[model samples]
Target: MIVELKNEQFYLCRHLLNRQAHLEPISVINQTNPGRVFVDDNTNPTSGMVWLGNNDGFIFFGNPHNEKFNQYIDPFIDQFLVEEAKKVDLDYMEAIGNSKDWNTTLEKVFKKRNHGNWNQRVYTLKNYEYLDKTEPNIELEYKIQKLDNRILTSVDLTNLDTLKENILESWSTIDDFCSKGIGFCIIVDNEIASYCYSNFVAGSVHCIAIETMEKYQGNKLAQKVAHTFVKECFIHKKLPYWDCMEDNDPSVAVAERLGFKSYFRYIGFDFSF
Candidate 1:
């Protein structure tokens, strides 16, 4: 019998999911602090698990597959976040995927609901090294340069609103990011030129997401901030994971520049109920 989990069981559940995270880190975001956790075996919540992070749902292969999951779980997930989930926010209920069973089940369910597909690609850092010393081939024009490492509860991007709508909107709130995630920003004249932070973190792995203002795109601010973020990841003994669309040249370029290697490719579907 599947049981809904409580805070007391978080440790055991996190342990199970963390082991699986080593293989599919992207699939197991925020498992350590999920909003809800369900497991077939209470003794080992990780053995057969479905974790509902703030917005994403995760499936793990532990116990034998059961048809009851399809029967009862869909409604539980469809109504998981209700109206807020239907909105296309960064932390919105976007996709559900993990092991083989997870992918197949999610595909079938969304198809039955007449939803479309959302394709995605995943990569991992390869022999990773910081870009702090490897400066980009660009002349520095800004007068005030600072690699502010403090996790700001709120970032000052007043001079760079374009980056806010185009990039930061998908990153939830500054307060949440500051408290739960770690980041570095290249502040130029009190404006955020480039920034890098953890979009998803679980266990020892952090998913890195970086954005540079349009005017500062070619100035190497991204490299500097990413270098700091990656260095911190190592300092904390955590691994870093990178994922982006296959056709996004800029992201692919940065990932490669940071020494990230293409490890796995997966699909994501941002469907509505």
Candidate 2:
């Protein structure tokens, strides 16, 4: 039978994650990020799954032939997962299989209910010097600001609400993000034009999420803000990670131009509620 593992016990699955130990799963296992884990055997797990705390996705790892794990998948998807997602006000669920065997198993189980299949690219920064530092040459009234309690709590700050929501997407709470996260933003006309922040973190590895206001897109503001965020990561001896859908040209371009090398590719699936 499949059994849920306590947060402290989440580390048991580390061996299964192997080379695909991205922040999402690592954060959960480290208990730095909220999430749930289940395994086919409590004492000696051979297969398992992680339900991301943010309800964003699931990670299927280990032996795909674990009968108990295989049997639990359908109900977990159709019943438990669906209910939990709705509680979070989400309309669908997403997942990734860690290995080719697991990938094929996921396809076989979720194919009919699949909403979409995405090819995701993961990047690693071997050298910090490759980050583009060329600021927008145009004259613009803007200032770079580090994210802090004041920035997170300011009620009247323009676009700050959107930033808070984005942070909450992957973080359990604003306070949690403030304490463990690092970020930088570009303010234009007293409004946040572009920002980059840690989305998921495990140990010294940080995965970043960045966004630029539509009106400010062409100003190279994203590059400017991201450059600072990355530099700060290096200053602290942290490893910055970048992951995005393969078809996300803009995101791919940003990482590539910043000198992040493609690390790995994985298949992800979206399932309907």
Candidate 3:
């Protein structure tokens, strides 16, 4: 059965770590140190899987596909979180996800915190099939090669002195998550022009922020980098997930051109912030 740790519990911690080891590594999840919440049929209190990390809040990571754990264990884990929230006098707790099963569970437990309706979020991407037919002209080729060269030469941020101030200032901890996957940059005549990266969550890969220098804005390097990144994700057997503010037209266009289909949309509730 599922168990919630009242305090530090070593065995439950081990089980959670073991479960993470078997799953496709998610960098965002890895960066957080949120402790464990348990699951398993073993009568021993320490046995079974535990969900680890805190995104906006706690994350549940146990195998939903396991028959015994899925049926007997997961519900209790859900109940445990809700009960714990009440016990701690938490005004609100929320879970964010694109999964129907997760939404169903959250619907039953979390009081629909997105107001009257769940947030409408979309995921879209273009694959290699869409990208292959597009040929870059001489100008486009020059820009793409410039970007490729910049990324290859300055794999780390330190060597990119000219771009360092702006990049480091704007970089997100989430960027570290993107680094765990594919990252690329565009350079123009030895100058860093633009760059993009992907952050993988389970099999879903989301493209992180792409930025172009003011001088490079009209060159379409952002589009090229994005297309290349999506191609890489597909080659790696990962689905590239593109999420942007609902009003972000440029991002939406890039994702559409790259062959990403809009799947679902979500709204965020930031109780913590």
lDDT of each: 0.56, 0.81, 0.48
Model 2 gets an lDDT of 0.81
Question: Which candidate should be chosen as best, given TM-score against the real structure?
Answer: 2
- Which residue runs of candidate 3 sit more than 4 Å off their true CA positions? 1-120, 124-131, 134-180, 201-209, 271-273
Per-residue C-alpha lDDT of model 2 across residues 162-223, encoded as one tens digit per residue:
88888887888988988898899888776888899998898888898989999988887877
Residue 2, candidate 1: C-alpha displacement in angstroms: 6.5
As a whole number from 0 to 100, the lDDT of residue 254 in candidate 3 is 68
RMSD of each: 5.0, 2.0, 8.6
RMSD of 3: 8.6
* Full ranking by lDDT: 2, 1, 3
* Candidate 3 residue-wise lDDT, 192-251, digit = tens: 677765433544445355666787777777777776666676777766666565677777
Clashing residue pairs in candidate 1 (N, C-alpha, C atoms within 3 angstroms): 125-260
